[model samples]
Target: MTPAETRTAGTTPAYAKGRQRREEIVTAAASVYADAGYHGASLRAIAKRVGISHATLIYYFPDREALLAAVLERRDEEDDARGFPREPVGIGGVRHLLALAAHNARHPGIVELYVRLAAEAITPEHPAHDYFTRHYRDARDYMHSAFSAMAEGGHLREGVDPRTAAVSFIALMDGLQVQWLTNPDAVDLVSPLRFFLQQVLTTSLDQALSRQS
Candidate 1:
């Protein structure tokens, strides 16, 4: 019998037991997928990990694509939940972003998943296309708003345009993570980010105040 069948064989109440089985399936699939990459992972392996029948896994996920999409969506929501600030970043904002960058850099699996899934999502017909598109847009919008507020508050130098600044800030973090993921020894990700932010703020604030002078 399939792994799915074996799992359901216990004969508990449908609603409660079904929910527990689904969570187990997702947990098993997530670990296998993260270790093996989406294409390398198989339904059989996920079933084996869950100690259920392949049919049981299928009953929950239906197919590999559905399982992969669930993983990506779950990760996106996790990222979003932590990405925005609860309070103003102010003098400490750059450090917070740098810390996040460092954390992502240390976790190569997460980075690899994001890079691979993002490329897949570009095909228009891909299941995650809409989700990835919206994720990027919303992240950019939040960043733009954050920087624009900081600039207007006179925390930034005058000549620095807030929108451009925000874009550059995100771009730098994205680019750095890619590099650091491959060469942690070559990149001082946090220090450099802090330095850059300090310089931008000083130059922009001086220029902003100079306009009044």
Candidate 2:
């Protein structure tokens, strides 16, 4: 049986401890993977980096793909923790989302990992394909709900499609991160994000208010 299977089957304190250790190993492995691409990184190197036996490392992440998936999961947790504000974000909430993005932008490694995984996740058998699919759907749903609320509350511009706007907004942000990976020096990410939010808010509010006029 696989280590993940074994770990799931047992519920003893030792098993719990093993799970925690595995999480730690995955986190350490993430750091290494972020620095070194998947092909460049090896289990032996990850074990050494985590100061654990090679067998122990393998016990948690049987292969590079598993380790990569763990890293992506960690990233998703972090993003959720930052609070992407529920549907129909107010102006302040939009600012908050931008702030979170700007803060996350500092970790170029995470951005690079995301970019790498985007290409790698195309295969049906890829471990991260499901994770990415779920992530995208969840994120889009959240954005759609928020924008719909805003539109209903007269925060959105007249005739503006909430879903389309949400998609475009997120697309722009994701695209910026991709660009930043190649030329971080060329973009002031925080300021640009803030500007985009302001523009969206202004146009939305004007349209909403104009309709009432």
Candidate 2 lDDT tens digits, 24-99 = 7777777776667665668888888778888877767666777776777778778767765344344444555566
Question: How many residue pairs clash per model?
Answer: 12, 2
In model 1, what lDDT does residue 92 have? 40
Question: What is the lDDT, from 0 to 100, of the residue 61 in candidate 1?
Answer: 72
Q: What TM-scores do the predictions have? A: 0.71, 0.77
Among all candidates shown, the one with the greatest TM-score: 2
For candidate 1, the per-residue lDDT at 49 reads 94
